[model samples]
Target: MRIAILAHEQFPDGAKTALGVLRYADDEVVAVLDRDRSGHRVTDFVSDVQDAPIVAGMGDLEDDVDALLIGIAPIGGGFEESWREDVRTALERGCDVVSGLHYFLSEDEEFVELAAENGCELRDVRRPPDDLSVSEGVAADVDAEVILTVGTDCSVGKMTATMKLARDARAAGYDAEVIPTGQTGIMIEGWGIPVDRVVSDFTAGAVEEMILECGDDHDYLFVEGQGSIVHPAYSGVTCGILHGAMPDRLVLCHDAGRQAIGGYESFSLPSIPTYVDLYERLAEPVRDAPVVAGALNTAGLAEPAAREAVDEFAASLDAPATDVIRFGTDEVLETLLSSNPNR
Candidate 1:
C-alpha cells in the first residue's frame, strides 16, 4: 500500500512507530507529515530507511496515498486534536486511516462517518480480540525456545532488537518468528495481539495465545516486548508479559546513557546491574528466564562512542551486547544459540 505517516512534530526520534514502519514495513511510504520538519527529506535525518518527503500536512502530498498511518505512539498513545484535520483530509480523499494509538479512531463518530461516506477503512491496530481470557501457563509448555526482549525502559529498542535477532536467527538457518506485542510489530508482521491495549486482566492471556500459536512451527520465538519493568505507568503491562510468555531466556534492552526514565525525569532509572537482577528475579518464580544478552540502543552516540557504550553495557550486564542496528546481531544471536545447547 502507498502510505503517508502522520507524525506531526515528532519526526525521526520521538516517532518510534513511524521509524519502525519506515525501516520494516513492506508498504511504500509516499510522504511523512511532520509540520516541524516540512520540506526536509527523511534521508536528511535517518539515511537507512526508505527515503520520503516530509510534508507539512495532507494537502502538501503531491501523490495519492492509499493509507495515512498514525506514526507517533506517545506516552499515553492519545490522538492529538491538531491531527484531526489531517485524518479528515485523508478520509475525504478516500484513503484508509490506520492508527496504532490507544485512542481508537474507529470509535470516533466523525471519523467513522467520514470513512463510511468515503468508502475508506479506519483500522485501529491496538484493538484486542474479543474472546481473550487470563493466561493458563500454557506458554511454558511450548516446544520452541522463547527469547523475550525485556527493557530497562519503554521505547529502548525492544521491538527493534526482537525483529533484528529474529531476522539474523533465520539467516543462520534456525526457524524463527517474531511474536509482536505492539502496534508497530503487528503492522510489520500482520498478526499479533497488542497486549498494552488488552484489558489488564487479559494482557498475559493475549501474549500466551500468540506464543502457543507459533511455537510448534518455529524453533525460536522472538517475542517483541513492551514497557519497562521499572516504569511506574507501564510496569503492569511489563509484568503481565513476563509472566505470560514464560520465556526460556531474556534479552535486556536499554538506551545507552539513559540514567532516567524517558518523559518521567523525576524518577531515575535503576543501574544496569539492578535492572538485570530485577528482570531475572521477577521471572524466576514463574520461569527460569535469565538475561542472556543485552541490546543497547546507541543511536544518539557516534560510531566510536556507540561501540564503547556497547562494550561498557556488556561489561555491566556480564553478557554479550551490541548495537544491533550499527553492528550486526551476530554476537547476540551466537550468545542466544550457545545458551540453548540442547535446543
Candidate 2:
C-alpha cells in the first residue's frame, strides 16, 4: 500500500509508532505529516525513518497514497481530538486509516460514516477479540526455536531489534516472525496481544498464545518484549512475558550511553555480564535459554562510538553482538542460523 504516516501534531517527540511504520512497514511510504518537522527530511533525524519528506498536513501529501497511519503513541495511549481533522482529510482522500492508539475510530459515528461513504476502512489496532483466552503455556512445546527480545529498560529498542531481525531473517530465506507483544507492534503487524492491556494474571497467557500460534508456522519466533525485568514500575508484565515465551535464545536489548534505568534514578543499570547472567538465572527453571546476542541501541551515538560499543559488548558475550540498526544484525543472525540447537 502507498502510505503517508499521519503524526502531524506530535512527531519528533513521542513518535515511536510513526518511526516504527517508517522503519519496518513494507508499503511505499510517500510522505510523513509532522507539522513540527515540515520542510525537513525524516532521515536527517532518525536514520532508520527512511527518506520521506516531512509535510505539515494532507494538503502537502504526494499523490497516490492509499493509507494514512496514525503514527504517534502518546502516553496512556489516548487519541487526541486535535488529530480528528487529519483523519477526516485522509478518509476523504480515499485512504484507509490505521491507528495504534487505544481510541477506536470505527466507533466514532463521524469517522464510521466517512469511511463507509468513501469505501475506506479504519483499523484500531488495540481492538481485542471477544473470545480471547488465558495463555496455556503451549508455546513451550512447539517445534521451532523460540527467541525473544528482552530489554535492559523500556523504550530501549526491543521492538526495533525484533523487527530488524525478522526482516533480515526473512531476507535470508527463513520463515521468521517477530511476535508483536505490544500495541505498536499490533498496529503495524495486524496481530499481537497488548500484553499490558490484558489483566495482569492473563498477560503471560496472552503472550504464550501468540508464541504457540506463530510457532507452528515459522522457523523462528522473535517475541517483541516489554518493560525491563529490572524496571521498578513495569517489571511484572516483563517477567510474565518472559515465562510465557519460553525462548531458547534471548536477544538482550540495551541502549548505548544510558547510565541509569530510565525514569528510575535510584537504580543503576547493571553490567553486561551481570544482566545476561541474571536473565539466564531467572529463566533457568522454566528453560535454559542463553542470552545469545546483544542488540545495542545506538541511535544517540556517533558512528565511531557505536561501533566501539558493539565491539566491547561482543567481547563480553560468548555470542556475537552489534548495533542492529546501524550495522545490521548479521553477526547475531549468522550465529543463530549456524548453531545446532541440540549440540
* Each model's backbone clash number: 0, 1
Question: Candidate 1: where is the Cα deviation over 4 Å?
Answer: 339-343
Model 1 has how many clashing residue pairs? 0
Candidate 2's error at 227, in angstroms?
Answer: 1.3
User: Which residue pairs in candidate 1 have backbone atoms (N, alpha carbon, C) closer than 3 angstroms, thus clashing?
Assistant: none
Best by TM-score: 1
Instruction: Pull out the clashing pairs in model 2.
Output: 135-205
Estimate, for each residue in 98-141, the C-alpha lDDT of model 1 and write its tens digit: 88988999999999999999999999989988999999988988
Worst 10 residues of 2 by lDDT: 334-343
Candidate 1 has its poorest 10 consecutive residues by lDDT at 334-343
